[model samples]
Target chain A: MTFVNVGTLGTQPGQREAVVAILTRANPQLAQAGCLLYEVGTSEESPDTVFVTELWTSAEAHQESLQLPSVREAIAEAMPLLNGQMSGFQYQISGSPLRD
Target chain B: MTFVNVGTLGTQPGQREAVVAILTRANPQLAQAGCLLYEVGTSEESPDTVFVTELWTSAEAHQESLQLPSVREAIAEAMPLLNGQMSGFQYQISGSPLRD
Candidate 1:
């Protein structure tokens, strides 16, 4: 089954740019891997909160991405920029997961 | 290669049961469709917030689910039970969409 991870990035005040920068620098490396989609965007309702959504070919692939040197470094660099808690869940694609 | 829709369901106070009830009622019907993975769960930190994550075989499948008579009816029935705005985004599974 395909795996997906849904999470949020809580950026500290005035640190949005740095967080995005970290993502920008990290995306290409992530894209080069087994990651099918690795994207980060701002929440429409909450500017301080960022939405991160991903789809991986397999659960193993998802686990491997965490070890990427660049991925870890970039995220570590952005850690100080965060304000609130970042959380996520893993799922096995079942069917059409949307309504419309 | 695959399409994913990430969104949330905002249930009004004391209406969590109504929302889950709605989803519980609609899931079997959703599973009968082209949906590959369809499930709902509560957030670990915020009991009031619900997180929905789905991976559809295609965007078309995602759209079709909306038209399902039961699906539509269920979501509509649960509308009044919502407290905050529910929003989502669509993505093409790019790679392994996660870190280890």
Candidate 2:
């Protein structure tokens, strides 16, 4: 089943753009790891937060990606920029109008 | 520039599956209207809420889609199944490494 992860990363004042940069950086490894879609954006309503939406082949693909060296490095690079206020939710994709 | 919308719709008790059904029904009209991605999902963290993530060629495309008869009809069908709680955020694409 396809797994979806939607979440926000809260950054310290003025650190939002930096986090967005890190998360949005190109990494071919993501697709090889089963990522279908990986989007990083910033919302007008929440200037301090960066919004991310991801689609993976499976829940396991997402979990295993966390242990990847490059992913770990990216997380390390982004952690300090964060404010520790993160909120998100994950789900298995049941369907899509276009895909159906 | 790409436009992204990430949001959640809170459904009436036990109406989640129904709402999901409505949101995920096949709609080729969405693509003709410039929708790149339109995903409907449900999260374990918030059982009553349905998550939606969308990507559009432009913000204008998304706004215009609302005026579409099919889109309006879909909204009407979904409104009653909802519990009046909705939270979402929209953003204009800055950049993405994958897309870059």
Candidate 3:
């Protein structure tokens, strides 16, 4: 059972664009690190919010990916644009919300 | 920002004590759907691999506490002990890998 790392980001009210830029630029690095899917999206109702969803092969694989210099650098770059504490979880997918 | 729903649960090796007793009895319906911190943890070198962490606030008040009904009958009785395909996201926290 692989792990999916899900995260939600809250930016500085109007700093959504900067956040998106950071995330978009960082996606390739994640992909190269065996990320099954990586996306950073904005909410229609909440303009200041950003959502990050990722699927990785395993916890160890995800950790190995994070150890890459590019991942570290990208995260460092994103750190400033963020506002509050980063909270997240790496889950094993208990149920599929998909209907297809 | 108020959104933190990170989950990682993989069972069936040893059932992880009945999935931690259905996540400790569903953690008070996710602490009245206003959960600040809910934890069901155990990973000393990965024992059947179960780790679920939550801290919810926004997201329409966690979807209005999942529309009650006893949290959908404790998630339909743990969806028959779960297996796979449940990916999760929903984050507002950006970076707080607490070190204190």
Candidate 4:
């Protein structure tokens, strides 16, 4: 089953773009580390939040990713731009939405 | 630009699978209405919450989908299975995380 982690990082006022920039730039080692998808997004409705939807090979694969230097570096860069407010959900894919 | 709507649906006790069945079965009109993806998931961590990640051609297309008979019927059927609890984020995709 694929492991999905979807969440938001609340940014400091006017810092959402900077945070998003750092996020989208982080990918060199991700694919090698079992990342299947890492989609980044933002919204006009939620100016201070950056949304992410990720798919990983497994929950363990996702946890191990945090120790990679590239991920750690990216987190360091994005940390200061954030407000420490976060919310999300984790799920092991249950089924395909389309039967076909 | 893809319009993304991702959220969690709180299922009534032990009704998660029933709710998931209805969601995954809703595909006849979705693709024609501009749905790119409709991923349904459930988590062991949050047993009662069903997570969804959707990609639509536009927010308007997603809005219009609710008017479809398939969608309307699905919503009506799943309503009773839900606990009236929901949480999610709406965002416009910014960019691919891979800078290449």
Candidate 5:
């Protein structure tokens, strides 16, 4: 089963784009570590909220990626732009096109 | 551009599986109407919460899908299983492997 991460990041007013830039630049490095999909998006309903949807080979892989220096650096950069309000859930992918 | 729907559906007790079944059965019908991806998952952190992650060709395609008879029927069936605490966001895909 694939591990899925779906979360919301609340950013300061006008800072969502900057946070997204860091995440966007970090994707290639993340993909090399078993990230099948990593999507970052901005909500139409909430301008300051950013949504990150990810698919990884396993929970361990996701954890391992976080420990990578590049990922750590990216997180450090994004931290200041965040408003400290974050909500997310982890799941085992039960159904998806990739499975088919 | 792709429109993404990432939402949480809170089920009544063990009703999460039942809700997932309805959504799973409705997938093929949804795909026929331009749904690129429709993934349904149950959160590991919250057993009663179901996450629906979808990618549509456009917001219009997604809107048109809601009018389909089969889709309407499925929603009606799933409603009774819901706890009425639904939270979701509509996003414009900013970065994703699909775009690459």
Candidate 6:
């Protein structure tokens, strides 16, 4: 099954866009490493929150991508903007638009 | 910008698959209503939680979809199976794999 990750990162007020920019710039590198979908956005209901949704070929692929230098650097850059409140859940995708 | 919804629905033990099935069956109709991406998944870390990730052409498109008879029926059908614990956030997608 494909691996799915959906998470929310809470940032300091007005820092949401910065965190999103860092993640968005890292997408090309992420896609090169088996990321099927890498989407980043800011919450409409919460001005200080950013949402990250990802789909990978497999859990192993996602784990391996984390080891890539680009991803590690992006994480390091985003850490400071984060407000220390984040939550996420991992899922096994059974169906998706890509399948059709 | 597209509208993105990332949410988790908690179901009764062993009812996750049933909820997924219903949502999966509803996808074609959703797509016809401007749903760019509609995926349903089961959490790897939580057996009774289901994740729904969606992308729509716009927030208005999503709102209109909810008024569709088919969508309303699906929601009505899924409500009974829900454990009444659900949380979600809406976002404005600025970047996605589909863009590239």
Best by DockQ: 2
Give lDDT: candidate 1, residue A59.
74
At residue B82, candidate 2 shows an lDDT of 99
Report every candidate's CA lDDT.
0.65, 0.88, 0.62, 0.87, 0.82, 0.82
Alpha-carbon runs more than 4 Å astray in model 2: none
Best-matching candidate per lDDT: 2
Where is model 1 more than 4 Å wrong at Cα? Answer: A26-28, A97-100, B1-5, B8-100
TM-score versus the correct structure, for each prediction: 0.54, 0.92, 0.50, 0.93, 0.88, 0.90
Model 3, residue A64: displacement in angstroms? 1.8
Per-residue alpha-carbon lDDT of model 2 for A4-98, expressed as tens digits? 88788889999998888888888888888998998888768788998888889999999999988889999999999999998877888778889
Contacts from the true interface found in each model, as a fraction, amount to 0.07, 0.69, 0.03, 0.68, 0.49, 0.50
Query: What's each prediction's clash count?
Result: 24, 0, 12, 0, 0, 0
* Deviating ranges (above 4 Å) for candidate 3: A94-100, B1-100
Q: Please provide, for model 2 over B1-51, each residue's C-alpha lDDT reduced to its tens digit, 9 standing for 90 to 100.
A: 789887889999999999999999999999999999988888777889998
Scored by TM-score, the top model is: 4
**Predicted candidate 5 versus true structure: per-residue lDDT over A1-100, tens digit per residue:** 7888888999999999998888877356677888987888887678898888888988899999999888899899999999999987778767753233
lDDT (Cα, tens digit) per residue for candidate 6, span B37-78: 887898667888889888898888999999988888888998
**With candidate 1 superimposed using the best TM-score fit, by how many Å does residue B65's alpha carbon deviate from the native?**
10
- Candidate 1, B1-100: lDDT as tens digits: 4566677766787776557656655356665666665555554444555556766777788888899888788778888888867766555543332332
Model 5 per-residue lDDT tens digits across residues B1-100: 7888778899999999888887777356677888987888886678898888888988899899999898898899999999999987777778863344
What tens-digit string does per-residue lDDT give for candidate 3 at A1-100? 5566666777886888788776666345566666765546565666777777566666777889878887788779887788885655555644221111
TM-score of chain A of each: 0.82, 0.96, 0.80, 0.95, 0.90, 0.89
For model 1, the docking class works out as incorrect
CAPRI classification of candidate 4: medium
* Candidate 3 global lDDT: 0.62
